[model samples]
Target: MNKFVYWVPAFIWIAVIYYSSSTPYEKQDIKPWLGDWVNLSWAGPYLERISFTYNNQEVSVAAQGIAGFIEFFIRKGAHIGVFFVLAFLIYFALFYTVQQNKNKPLLAASAWAGTVLYAVFDEWHQGLTPNRTPYAGDVLLDAFGGGLAVFVILSVHRKNGRKKKFNIE
Candidate 1:
């Protein structure tokens, strides 16, 4: 029971990603809602204060345009952010589930493998959904997210000498 607890959070997060992905990409409207919210009268002056030059033209004419761009970045960033958390959870679960005397490197590698594999599976799942096509680039991004988390976790563990303290070989 104690060992199972470590996996619960990972499973829940994966389920969340799966549920969200089940929605058609065209139907994903978080961006429009966000654009409307940011277009409030009170936000006009604040939005006006920000400006950027794109193709030698000032591109701050409309708040909605900027909001749409922001939304695009937010969506991609969410992929990395959520996968980072998932990888960390997977690392903890793997670390605890393996027999005693496991090495930190091996545990980290296993976590990365699990995360990348999941990313592949997720993209495949998305492909089966309507109007969604799998992209190798997205898989690479997911792997980067997961790999970064594993690297950070491993560094912290090694810095703290956790291997010796926790009996991780």
Candidate 2:
């Protein structure tokens, strides 16, 4: 198989991330959809008890109401999920395209590095888009997602009895 074939998914995923980042937040708001799909009013009292500040903004049912509160978490979770998948896809591409004997740790590191760099770029791109505020916290969340992917990959390799030293030197 052509090595380039291994990279198609990663490239496509990158495009998806780019397109999502390019959209204005108003178009991406999910509160109305959530309101249409589910009844969260029952939890409003409980949600109202939860209050905190994030990125200089209040995040709670009191600040955003039930639907907005739920949407906040959903959007943050999407950040983690999308980047998690991107990291794994990047690792998959690197595993197939690199020399067979290349160190797995190095490959994992490279995948994580790529994910972080892309997250930085994505945030920067979002900053340029109207109604989008780039938060460093989101980038940290993305890095955590990529790190989780690396951990899962390493754990899987260890479970498969590879026991390869994880040194990146």
lDDT of 1 by residue, 65-168 (tens): 65655664577678788788889989889888887878988888888888899999998998888987787767888898998998899789776796788777
What tens-digit string does per-residue lDDT give for candidate 2 at 70-156? 999999999999999999999999998998677889999999999999999999999999999899999999999999999999899
Q: CA lDDT of 55 in candidate 1?
A: 31
Stretches > 4 Å off in candidate 1: 39-64, 162-169
Against the correct fold, how does model 1 do in TM-score? Answer: 0.76
TM-score of 2: 0.93
Write out the backbone clash pairs for model 1. Answer: none
Worst 10 residues of 1 by lDDT: 54-63
